[model samples]
Target chain A: MRALFAFIAGGLFGSGLFISGMTDTAKVQGWLDVFGAWDPTLAFVMGGAMIPMAIAWIIRARRDTPVLGGTFPPPAPREIDRKLIIGSVLFGAGWGLAGLCPGPSLASLSYGGIGHWVFFVAMLGGMLVAPRLSIRLDRTVPAE
Target chain B: MVMDWVWGLVGGLLIGLGGAVYLLANGRIMGASGIIGGLVDGTGRRDAVERVAFLAGVFLLPVLLYPLYTSIDTHITGNWGVLIAAGLLVGIGTRIANGCTSGHGVCGMSRLAPRGFIATVAYILAGGLGVVLFRHVLGVI
Candidate 1:
């Protein structure tokens, strides 16, 4: 039952990504191109996505358990640590380089681009090594 | 415009609504990275079914729905070197940060999480710099 809801939600999310032009790598790159020919379409997408999310947060303030009988998780930590900063930096670099982020990467699999498969596999490999690499990063740059 | 902003907005609303449902139903944030991350790293073994179900829907629906609408192109670069390098960076970065654009950018920022704001800023800035470095300077991307 819970999985069913999750499945439906995922379907909605992926469909949204597809319609929003997020799965289009070129559009993503255009949005990132602050200095060049900037496309403002992503701003609308970001704004559109945030509206319902903000409403959800507002609605949550009045409730305890969700409509589905689950406990609402606590807020994320407030600390702005090195891990968050550095990790975001690296992620952004990759996002700029490939114009692919996690959601769109997964969403683009059906696009049948060899680059997508290669990026997906490579992403998994990177995820596999992340624990060790992050430990090393912490030693060099420190973690929260 | 290459594409319409109306579609972007409509799509975003669906994405947000999906996330809202996930939060309201599962009491979990709808982040692609965290969901997939926990599954991949074995930390989310208990919830493996949920994660996989979510992924299955995200991945498989497009196969059926995409052709129904229209055949879309990813327009991703053919440079394998850049693709590999970027994939690794994204994987490692999102893992370490524990969020991505969907996770931190949408869910966090919408709720006014400071970490989300910072992460979003950092990534956007870094992404722009990367464009400058790769496209303008080195001509790699």
Candidate 2:
């Protein structure tokens, strides 16, 4: 049952990405191109996303248990440390350069865009490699 | 313009609803980065059914929608090396930060998690600087 809901939800998310045309890497890359004719599409997309998110958040906050079952687990707490800074910096650089983050990249793979395949492979590899590095370094940070 | 807004809203709702549903049902937050991260550490089976379904949806959505909207265009200029390097960096970032923009920006923020707040602010600042670095400083644009 939970899996089914998640599937439906994921489908909704992917459809949204597809409908917003975010699967098109050029459009995403355009947002990063601030000087050579700026594309405000990404901003608009962000704006569009915030609306429903805000509403859903409000609803979730007011309730103790969700309509489905358990109580909200709430995210774990942590301080902003060196790992946070470096990781975020890396994320920003990658996003600005590639114009596709993990979620959208995964979403876009359906388009069969070669770029997505490259992005997905690299993303999976990163997911694998980052953990081994963490284990090797004896770091205990949760993979965000 | 209308289509764009509609799609964006739908996508947001889906994520929010999915997240809410996931949290309500399993007492777990719907964070892709974390789930993906956990999948690496052998916790994959803990939520095996849901995780695989969520991931599959991520890949299947666009394929279903392509026929309805024909204006899609995906192009890239940079070489594969750069893209791979970027992915590596992002992987490291998510691990260190303990959340991605989605986890912090949506799930965390929704729960008013302080860490999420700080992480998100940092994310925005870094994102801004990265754009400047790539477009202006490096002249990639």
Candidate 3:
């Protein structure tokens, strides 16, 4: 049941990504190109996706357990720490550089050509090394 | 017929509905980075099946309906330096930050989580800056 949920949800997410123009590298970069020939469509995509998700949170509050039998995550800690800030900055920089994030990076794999594969492999390597790098980060800026 | 912000909204709705389903039914946040990152990093080795299954679905859907999306154009950078650097940054950043566009921008912000808002703002700001630096200044890509 959980697997079923994941598969269906994944399909929907992928379909939306393609349909919404999230998969278009030039379009994504255009959205970020505020200083140049900027595109404002991504705002709609971002804003629109939030509506259903916001409602889901409302539903989540009244419900106890999930339909497929799992515990909902506890509320995220209300801390604004170094890890999050630094990490997000880095992610944004990379996103701007590539015009692709985790979801679309994978979604475009089959047909996004060699460049997509290169990004994927590099991203995978990064994911593997993140924990070690994170440990080092913790050493420098111990969490509060 | 012109692809404009309307399609963006529709696609956004679908993405949100996807998040809604995963959140309500699976009892998970449906953050793409977290789902895949956990498995690769060993923190989520126990739930390998869940992660792999989800990925399979994410990857397969586009191809299964290839006929419909044949004109898919990603326009990804062919510059190896940019691709590697960008990919590494995204992988490391999203994992350490504990979310990405899907988790933080969509799921996290939707719930009004402070981290979500902060992360979203940070990434957007950095992404714009990245454009300035990588494209405008360096002319690397």
**Top candidate, metric TM-score:** 3
Worst 10 residues of 2 chain A by lDDT: A44-53
Model 1 C-alpha lDDT per residue in residues A1-144, reported as the tens digit of each score: 889999988998998888898988888888888878898888888899999999999998889898778689887799887899989999999999999999889988977579999888888877878888778877896343
Candidate 3 accuracy as lDDT: 0.89
* Candidate 2 per-residue C-alpha lDDT over B25-128 given as tens digits, one digit per residue, 9 for 90 to 100: 55566666777766765557777777888778867877776787656666654577767776776666676566776677677776667777777677656666
Clashes by residue pair, model 1: none
Mark the regions of model 3 whose C-alpha exceeds 4 Å error after superposition: A142-144
Instruction: Write candidate 3's Cα lDDT for A48-69 as tens digits.
Output: 8999999999999999988788
Candidate order, TM-score descending: 3, 1, 2
- Full candidate order by DockQ, most accurate first: 3, 1, 2
Clashes of each: 0, 3, 0
Displacement of residue A137 (Cα, Å) in model 3 is 1.5
For each candidate, what TM-score against the reference?
Answer: 0.95, 0.83, 0.96
Q: Which predicted model would earn the best DockQ?
A: 3
The pairs that clash in candidate 3 are none
What lDDT score is found at residue B1 in candidate 1?
75
Using DockQ as the measure, name the better of candidate 1 and candidate 2. Answer: 1
